[model samples]
Target: MFDKVLVANRGEIAVRVIRACKDLGIGTVAVYSEADKHGGHVRFADEAYNVGPARAADSYLDHEAIIETAKQAGADAIHPGYGFLAENAEFAGKVESTDGVVWVGPSSDAMEQLGEKTKARAVMSDADVPIVPGTDPIEEPDAVRTFAEEHGYPIAIKAEGGGGGRGMKIVREESEIEEQLESAKREGEAYFDNDSVYLERYIENPRHIEVQVIADEHGNVRHLGERDCSLQRRHQKVIEEGPSSALSEGLREEILEAARRGVDAAGYYNAGTVEFLVEEDPDRAPGERLDDDTDFYFLEVNTRIQVEHTVTEEITGIDIVKWQLRVAAGDEIGFAQSDVAFDGHAMEFRINAENAAEDFAPATGGTLETYDPPGGIGVRMDDALRQGDDLVTDYDSMVAKLIVHGSDREECLARSRRALAEYDIEGIPTIIPFHRLMLTDGPFVDGTHHTKYLDEDLDTERIEEAQAKWGTDGEAAASGGDGTTTQELTIEVDGKRFDVKLENPGLPTNGAGQQAAGGGGAGGGTTSASGGSGGDQAATLEGQQVTAEMQGTILEVNVEEGDEVASGDVICVLEAMKMENDVVAPSGGTVTHVAVSSGDSVDMGDTLLALE
Candidate 1:
């Protein structure tokens, strides 16, 4: 076993890895950014170090800083939790090469071979695994058109190193080919540092199924089971359930075996997931199951622990994270394939800090005035949030995950309803209401909803109603303040965060403090990463300004000064919360001024361009 393990990530996953290390009697080290100086993971770990600023590029994604922190902490191993450098082959190789530190995941060679989508598809094809017809790394738009000629319309332009919909775009018509292709490549480069992209024949209706597999250094591999993540919005999974109710016994076995074969063929080890797209039969009855003949194609591989690994844990009595550590330490499998058995059905709902009624807009700023999670038999909550903690809007929107287990799917749904109802949150907009609404949704309850169901089929009015009924008014709590005469200062010593308190015995409290208590304070306003308010830019900009709708980095400015644009024309692309949003022109006009460029950090309402 390792003496000390450094977690090179933040949020719940970092806390999760720390807990696993503690359970195995290993020391844990946590790395945090300035924005996360007060993060829950930092408090939970035995020791913590500051990496960089709030912007992920300078902090969480800085491979060198994290590696140096691990060295300073005397951590013998580095565990890159999902996201950031988790799947980066270069970072993994660096950790592997470090004198006394080991990387607690698959070998860098295996990650490089499978992390790239085009290469993974080639490997899967050689292993006789079914894959969707697609083209290799394509540069020109003509390649997309040519592929579309044979594959037909609705082509999926995917980044070579992208997953979780970060660098993916769907083109449904000829006119959208160039725009979607550029956006896909731009996202690919911005997110993965790779502009390489490929094409796939988009499946109109499919169930997103993935088999979780883990292997040890002793060459023993095991498939935990399958998870259905069809409940998605814009290709990002919102909910996931294990032992899919839509797959028959034979079909399930086939998919699971295929996943194992793909992993074994790639010479992979440690934790990984083999994703597949199972075609859904629209004409089939509501309760009908997919048989052996149903078409299923390999999607891609997630080379690290998944967010919904909790679902598999609830159904199977296996501690996947523990196995990850054991395998990395050169341990052999303790059980055979047949010995692995699933106990019951389980589902995981992502508790994201977004408003589903407003197109799932990520919250800009708010404090967790009240935070309460449900608990009981068959219910588990994985989170790192605390009451009064201000919501960190710098990274992803996911606040936590809710996992529910039951003897059967019916009972699981019933229990989920109770758990969601019992879950309470305040001062931050979340998708709790949407999850509650899904319990009564017919298609979802029948387990027939495909990956595109939420994006294309669900009614918007019902979501609005759900939000109106159950949603919290974040503005009130975000603007509210508590009276205090003492002011605290945050200081850093050798890249370690520390808090200092300064007290004034006779200081007047009736000025700023009293006004803050009456709803006027720094908490009432949101500042961009560049330390500027969006409203300030809007006030000075002239003409018809196209302002950002959320806080993110400007990935691309489509129109420059003097460029003519029409209504609904994309003026720029904004990357936010791991998703890309197009900022379009409100009306036909000529571009007068461009306020932002690629790689500029922006907040909600910051002007991107002005039209005359």
Candidate 2:
């Protein structure tokens, strides 16, 4: 066992690793950015260190800083929790060479070979795993067109070094091939730093199934069963389950064996996932069981712990993370392949802080006034934040994960409904209503919802109906934060110093709340303010107030003052949580004023421009 492990990540995943370390009686070190000086993970760890700024590039992803921090903290190993630098082969290599610090994951060589898409496909092919027909590293647009002509339209352009659906683009028609190809290349470079892309025959409807595998340096390789992660939004998984309801017993066995064989063939060690795209039979109905002849092909390999790994753990009773650390420490595989056990049906719902009705857009600014999660025999809440902690808008929107287990999928669904109803949160919108509705929705209950179910079939009106019953937006806005902590900072104004109490929203004034001055703290970017009652028009003055749709940094402003733009013309682009969103003109007119610049941070509903 490691004497100390530095967690090179943040939020729920960081908390997850820290808890694992504690269970092993291992010391843990947590790293945080300026924005997360007092983050939940930091609070839970044995010790914490400041990395850099709030931006991930400068903080969690700073490879050098993380390695240095591990040495300083006297950590014998470093655990790169999922996301951030977890899958970066270069980081893994650096840790491997860092004198005494061991990397608690797969070898960098294995990661580089298996983490890249094209390379993984080749290795899987050599291992006799069924692979999707695709071209090699595609460089020109002609390659995409040629592949599409051979494979038919609706080809998928995927980044060679991408996973979790980040650097992928789909071309549905011949006319869109060129444009989508360029867009795919751009995203591939921007997200993965690799513009090399490949084309494959895109399956119309598929269920995403993955097998969890762990191997030891002693040559023992085994699989921990499989997980069904079919429910998704814009390629991001929202819900996941174990022992796919769609897979036949025989097919399941084949898939599991294939995953184990594929990883073993690549000489991969430590924790990894072998993902497969199970193509739905074209003639099969929604609720029909898959036939013995149903086709399943290898998708890719995720060389790190997954967000939905809880589902696998609940069913298999396996401590995957513990196994990861043990394997890295030269520990032998605890159990043989046949000794692996899986019991009961389990499901994991990603409790994200986003509005489902509003296209799953993240909350701009809000404090967690209430964060009461559910509890019981078969429920587990994995999270980092506690009540009154402000939501971190600079990263992923997932606030936590709620996993439920039961005797079967039926009981699991029932338990999910009860747990979701009991899961209380305030001050920020979440997709809880969406998860609640999935329990009752016939397609989901029957385990028939495909990856495109949410985006393609689930009606927005139905989602709105569910939100009305379970959503907290209406009530949360009324409820405020609980006064708990306090901070004081000094700011210079006209060479005069004044002690001002910057109140957190929904908390009581610290004697002089209204007179609180902001912008003196680390995360002091924006604040909501209102004009005096008598100074501005009494109730409201109506012009045209163009506002931001979500909280983000202004990446580029397309329109300047007095510039004309038609309705739907993109006026600016926003970079939020590593995603680029276009803020466009709502109505055709001249820009009266540009309230923000390229480098300004903004909150949702803050005016970006005004038009008359």
Candidate 3:
């Protein structure tokens, strides 16, 4: 076993990796950015280091800083927990080449071959795995039109290095081909540093199913079964469950075998997920299951531990993360494929810090005044926040995950309702109300909900009613600290990180308080804090001003100082929480002044431009 391992991520996932390392009797090291200096993961690890600033590009995604920190901490291996540089093949190659250090994932060559969508599709096709009809890397808008002509309307343009709906766009007609194609390419470049994209025949109503597979260096592979993630919003999964209620026994077996076959053909190792899009029969009854002849197509391969892996763990009684460590240490699989048997049904609910009624807008700020999670049999809470910890709005909004297990799907749903009701979080907005509403929803409870159900079919008024009944009111102003204070400083001695604290007798309270959390409304209020890297506020500007709705970095400035634009025209693109959003003109006008550039970071309410 390795002596020590460094976790190159943040939030609950980082803490999860550290705990797994500790279970194997290995020392753990943590690296955090300036915004995460007081993160729970840093406090749990044996040693921690400050990598860079709050911006992810300068901190969590900085390859050189993370590698150097691992070396200085005397760690022998590095584990990337999901996001950031988890599936980055170049970073894996760098770690592989570093002496005396091991990368706890697949080989760089295998990652490059499977991480790209087109290449993986080729590999799966060659392995006799059913794949959706799609094109290779496309360059122009004409290519998209041609594909749509053959595949019919509603084509999906996906980025080469994209997953979890980051760099994917949907075009329903020829008129939207050019704009959607450009937006997809821009998001690809901003998120994955790859401008390449491909086309696929979009399945209108399909269940998002995925199989969890793990392999070792000795050619031993195992599949833990399948998970259904059809409940989604904006193409991102909201709730995931294992042992799908919509699949027959024979159909489930086929999917499991296909997942194993694809991974084995790609020569992949460690933990990975093989996702598929299974077509749904709308004419079938509510509780009907898909037969063996049902159509299913390979979607993509997630090259790391998934956010919903806990569901599989609960049902199969397997320690997937520990297996990741053991496989990296050159251990062979001791159990056969037949030994993997699921015990019960499990569901994982992502406790994101967002208001679901208001289109799921991410929360700006606020402290966790009352952070209480439910406990008992068959309920697991994976989180890193304490009672008084302030919510971090710089990264993903998912602060915790609630996984419930039971003997059957009905029992699982029943337990989930109770668990969600028991979860208490104040001073910030969360989607607990939405989860509760889903438990009572007809299609979801009957296992007939598809990937587009939330975005397309569900009535918005029901969501509003749920939020009004059960949502938390986070509009109250947060109280600043008392008189006494302690300041923490990070110092380095001989390239090793050490934290220093200094006490002060009398100090004034923070007059400029933190940004209030989102309430059950359309928009969250402003912040007393100053403007970010986007320069000063636009108080002097006279025309209609465009402001940022969330904290994010500018990826592109579409308008100049005096550019003519119509109403609803995109003015700029902002990258936040690993997703791209376009800031558009509220009304038709000419740009009077621009306050931000392509790479500037902006906080909520920061002015981006002014229009007349």
| The candidate that achieves the highest TM-score relative to the unseen native structure | 3
Candidate 1: residue 601 lDDT (0-100): 87
Per-model lDDT: 0.87, 0.83, 0.87
What TM-score, over all chains together, does every model reach? 0.88, 0.85, 0.89
Per-candidate RMSD, Å: 9.0, 9.9, 9.7
After best superposition, candidate 2 residue 505: deviation in angstroms? 24
lDDT for each residue of candidate 3 in 1-612, tens digit (9 for 90 to 100): 999999999999998999999999999999999999999999999999999998888999999999999999999999998988989999999999999999998888888988999999999999889999999999999999889778898999999988888789999989999888988888888778898999999999899999999999999999999999999988899999999999999999999999999999999999999999999988767878999999999999988999999999999999999999999999998789989988989999999998877788888887887899998888998999988998999888988999999999999999999999899887788889999999999999999999999999999999978876677435321211233334446999999999674444344324232222332222334322222222355667767678887898899998899899998888888887667888888888888889899878877788888878
Query: What's the C-alpha lDDT at position 263 in model 1?
Result: 94
Q: Which residue pairs in candidate 3 have backbone atoms (N, alpha carbon, C) closer than 3 angstroms, thus clashing? A: none
| TM-score, candidate number 2 | 0.85
Model 1 clash pairs are none
Kindly list the per-residue Cα lDDT of model 2 for residues 471-590, writing each as its tens digit.
654222222334322333578899999854343543433322232354232224322221112112212423466676666677668888888889899888776655678887778888
